[model samples]
Target: MKKEFAVIGLGRFGGSICRALSTEGMQVLAIDKDEEKVNEFKNIASHAVILDSTDEVSLKEIGISNFEHVIVAIGENIQASILTTVILSELGVQRITVKAQNDYHEKILNKIGAHQIVHPERDMGRRIAHNLISNNILDYLELSDEHSIVEVKAGRKMKGKTLIDLDIRANYGCNVVAIKQGKSINVSPMADEILKEDDVLIVIGADIDISRFEKNLVIDD
Candidate 1:
């Protein structure tokens, strides 16, 4: 089954989403008030339209409600973004993800019923900072203010060590949810399995515990 998605506002963020979704073979409707932005995505998305998202009649005409997921990525125009979200919420869009410009904008988006709010610039900065701080960290996902899920690559200290020998759970209080070796992933890695070189461990736990784990095991002595 092909999943359907709609993205409103075709700036850098929305354009990226449009390309990524289309690349995955999903049906996407790209909408933007800017004609040039819409035209740019015509070949990339399933459908691209130039329309005012703030207008309720225009949104309904495009059948925006039919999409299971809709992203409000309107840039600069905070008023238009809010109005569009209100209409989407009233129309009962299943999932609404909005890009927030600031703290005040995020608060309004939350009150208007956005399912997910993304702070792109802030998030990217955090991710880069984490990668710079821990050389072995391949990826970092913030689950909450206090917790994160990180993909930590096996370093010299972790090579040939089993889960039990490392005592990851008891010592650092983090759980290895999966182990990735090349393209194959083991969701249920055994306790006695020896970690090989270049193995990526997907671990989830509190931020403090993850930091401790990195300090003790990931970095070189």
Candidate 2:
């Protein structure tokens, strides 16, 4: 069954999501107050409307509650974002995802019953910074304030060493969740599986522990 989604705000983040979801064959209703923004997405989305999302009447008129998931991606206007989320919650929207500007915004959205909160800018900044600092670190994701998941290339020192021999969990307090070799991925790799020099390890642990493991694992040529 095809899922129905509503994306409000029509800013870069919201507009991109609407286009992507529509491309994936999901029914998407794109809403924005700006006529220009709505017109831009008219050809891409299932439906595009120019209206104030904070207005409960307008939301109801568009059948917003019928959507399986609704994304509030208002940028710059914190008040509008909060109000929209509150109205959606009150209307009994099945799932609501909100883009928050800061910690305070996230707290209010959470309190108002937002199902998910995304800090896209902060997450992207962290990922870019991590990639810039370490050449061996391919990617980084902040799972929480204290924990992270990272992808790091296996160093020469780690070549031909089985998971039991490395004992990453016992030594570095991190778990190797997956191994990426060429185009193939081995998720939940066995302890006896050997790692090659070019293998990429997807590891998850506390930030401090992950930092420690990265420093110890990567060696300059």
Instruction: Give lDDT tens digits, candidate 1, residues 1-221.
Output: 99899999999999999999999999999999889999999999999999999889999998999999999999988999899999999999999999999999999999998999998888888889879986888888988779999998999999999988998999999999999999999997999999986999999999999999989998767
The runs of at least 3 residues in candidate 1 whose Cα sits more than 4 Å from the true structure, single-residue gaps closed, are: none
Question: In candidate 2, which residue pairs get closer than 3 Å at backbone N, Cα or C atoms, i.e. clash?
Answer: none
Q: How many angstroms is residue 2 displaced in model 1 relative to the true structure, after the best TM-score fit?
A: 0.9
> Model 1 reaches what TM-score against the true structure?
0.94
Candidate 2 residue-wise lDDT, 131-185, digit = tens: 8877788999998889999998887768899989988899899999999999999
Residue 70 in candidate 1 has what lDDT?
Answer: 98
lDDT minimum window of 10 residues, candidate 1: 130-139
**Which residue pairs clash within candidate 1?**
none
List candidate 2 segments past 4 Å from native.
Answer: 219-221
